[model samples]
Target: MVVRRCLVLLVATAAHVGCTYDFDAFMPSGAIDSDLVDDTSSGDAVADDAAAPLDSAIEDVIADANVEASDDVSVETSADTSADTAADTSADASADGSADTGGATDTGLVDTATPDVPVSCPDPEGKALGTHCYFPLAADNWDKAKAGCEARGAHLVTITSAAEEIHVESIRTGKDRWLGLRRPAGSPIGEGSFAWITTESVTFKKWGGGQPSGAGECAVLRAGNDWADLGCKSPRDPICERD
Candidate 1:
């Protein structure tokens, strides 16, 4: 029994040297042994110290994320406000332009007058010349040509200006054409004394050389684009004029 007790004490001493309490647990319940308690406070302190840096890093990440989110929201709000302002400005400008156009229309500044539509020549064969229509007729005497022109609701062509004479010259055939000029009773044998069949005033004349010569009553448009008196019975093509 003595040897066994000595061996058990040797084992407990060895176990205490190894920093274990397995052998100390067999002591009396009321006995206080300082080395019997496992001192884990130092390990827990090390763990807490290690976790602080990670926690701080996590807090910094969260703060940065919150700041970035705030910036994004602010940018989006500013962009939306700018877009709304531009839209309003565009709408206002369009409204002003429309109002201006309406005001112009109301003030009669817009030319709403129907544009003058030109009247077409009455006869399909009639050629439009200047402001009138001209029809070159077949060979006929002055009286017959006058009658033909009246039948067609027209008058024998009259030259009222040099421009009109140029216009008539453009359509001159190879032969002379009868004009509407004739001498009236009590009239002299001069260019001024002759009158158009339409009774228009004798405002212009192109008598050839020194002629009226009282050669005949009626006049003819020579191929050289001048006028000469001729007999009323002579056969010549006539040019008819109308609006």
Candidate 2:
């Protein structure tokens, strides 16, 4: 009985050994599970990191777009301001130019139309004759007397007719004054009608009473105030009339 019991015990022990689980294989399985879990975690972390970088890039693009818009607005505003300034400057210059031109024209017009006034003659050396104001030249040859009067811007007194000559003779002042009358030597007596050399006509005349009849063809005024037909070369004071 004891031997049989020993044999059974041995067989049972061997079978147990043969049916026992393989520890090495179990360990390898557990290790495989751990590696899978680690790999999955690492992949998840990498995905998260890539997503963050993409978001950052999107944000940078947005910021750049905003900066460009601001710069464009500033440029447009500056251009507008400059244009307004230029327009104002042009208007002001035009106004100033017009005003200056008008002023210049007015000045030019005013300068061209003013008239000159006449001057008055000085007095005392010569006496005034008639209401018309005549001056007498001092005694000189007839031609010289005439030239003297002309130099003073006057002409020898002109006598129109015999009646005017008579009238001039009435104002005698007791001196042999020159008359416009002149008789060339050897000229006929009555044939020479009295006339003024300046006017070349018998417009005014004055003769002393019965004066220019015959031998008195050559004549002189009795006073500085009278008129008579006289010799051409006779030296005497002459009267000058201002026009």
Candidate 3:
């Protein structure tokens, strides 16, 4: 006759766990030809040996379960790391692409920090280019000229395109005029790194050959054609612009 039995072993992780083990035993029945009482002990010993294998199998199952749990944890950790990396990448992309990608020039930069003002030209006498209008006035130093433009709800022009440059040249009746471009103070004034205060980008530039030779701190449209670096205090009429 044979009998089968199942045993269960419970394991625990920091979180949770369980496992199952089965043991089978064979027993002999009916009278034997040689009935040796001493042999009975041998039979019992053989049963113990068989049970040893069952114990070993249970241990093996538990070890395998532990390894599987550890592997699951490791996989989850790796997945979390990947998700974090992806999120960081998305944030960076949004930071850089938001401006140029969206039609709001410098939407990702300085312009975004300020209010989104709708550009409107109440006076049509001044030439309109892009989103702003330009007005040519008499001569004055860079600071005074900027102030004057401000008095009229405008600022010095910031040229960012070739078309705008051409328009300025076409209508410029007098000498060169001051533009809003400026070099960093305490830094080389005219070596050509400039920014547009009204907007966040320099879309166009036309500097004269050897002009700005690191000469002065302010920028001007010379002959309304090309740009040159000049002293900030130099007397020159500004091409006022407003949106």
Candidate 4:
């Protein structure tokens, strides 16, 4: 009866407290009971059932953490990719700009349209002679010849030395040519009264024999390579000179 009452008390306590115990494992071998052993097995089954939900909760937390980590990594990768693309674009633009600048520099350094020509003679057809240019004009009167020479920025040829006289005489076409020498009206038939039309001082003279018989005011270089006075209206080819 006492053992039966103790058993009844143990069942009452277990129902009231909602707790479990390993009754058979703690009991002495002489006091072991089969019903209590069955209760101990049931308690172990409840403990395992309670632990299963905790394990599932822990697994759920781990899975959520893994998902968040994956999202962070994806964000970082996307940001890095964008930065790399921007950097590459900037670099490419810089390279293109540098290439364009270099091309412009190379093109600007060279010019290819103009050429070189001689600088001594202003008239392209004039002959360059001993530091001057000489050109022969068509037959014209003295005043007209002087005007023509002035129009072309030149003057009638003036011979100042025997060497120049010889040089010009060699190039003459054997035609009577007008000289720049002229005599002022009412002046004597001497060299002192003559002046070069170009205003150059008369430093030399090679008059032909018995010349300046006071024919006129203008002078001429005769075909025989000597100078003589003549009428200003006489037609003769003009020799033009310029430095």
Error of 4 at 188 (Å): 1.4
Ranking by TM-score: 1, 4, 3, 2
State every prediction's TM-score relative to the real structure.
Answer: 0.53, 0.39, 0.47, 0.49
- Model 1 lDDT-worst window of ten: 32-41
Q: Tell how far residue 225 is off in model 4, in angstroms.
A: 0.3
When 1 and 3 are scored with TM-score, the better candidate is 1
Clashes by residue pair, model 1: none
lDDT of 2 at 86: 99
Q: Supply the TM-score for candidate 3.
A: 0.47
Candidate 1 wrong stretches, greater than 4 Å: 1-105, 108-114, 122-125
Compare the candidates by TM-score and give the number of the best one: 1
| Per-residue alpha-carbon lDDT of candidate 1 for residues 1-243, written as tens digits (9 for 90 to 100) | 453334344444444344434534755554533432343334334435545665677689999999999999999999999999999999998788789887343454667788756657767456776568877777578888888887888888888889888777766666788877889755688887798877789899899898887878888889988999988888988888885
The clash number for model 3 is: 2
Query: What's the CA error at residue 28 for candidate 3, in Å?
Result: 89
Best-to-worst ranking by lDDT: 4, 1, 3, 2
Q: Superpose all Cα atoms of candidate 2 onto the true structure and report the RMSD in Å to 1 decimal.
A: 22.8
TM-score of 1: 0.53
Error of 1 at 195 (Å): 1.4
Report the number of clashing residue pairs per model.
0, 18, 2, 0
* Best-performing candidate as measured by lDDT: 4
lDDT of each: 0.74, 0.59, 0.69, 0.78
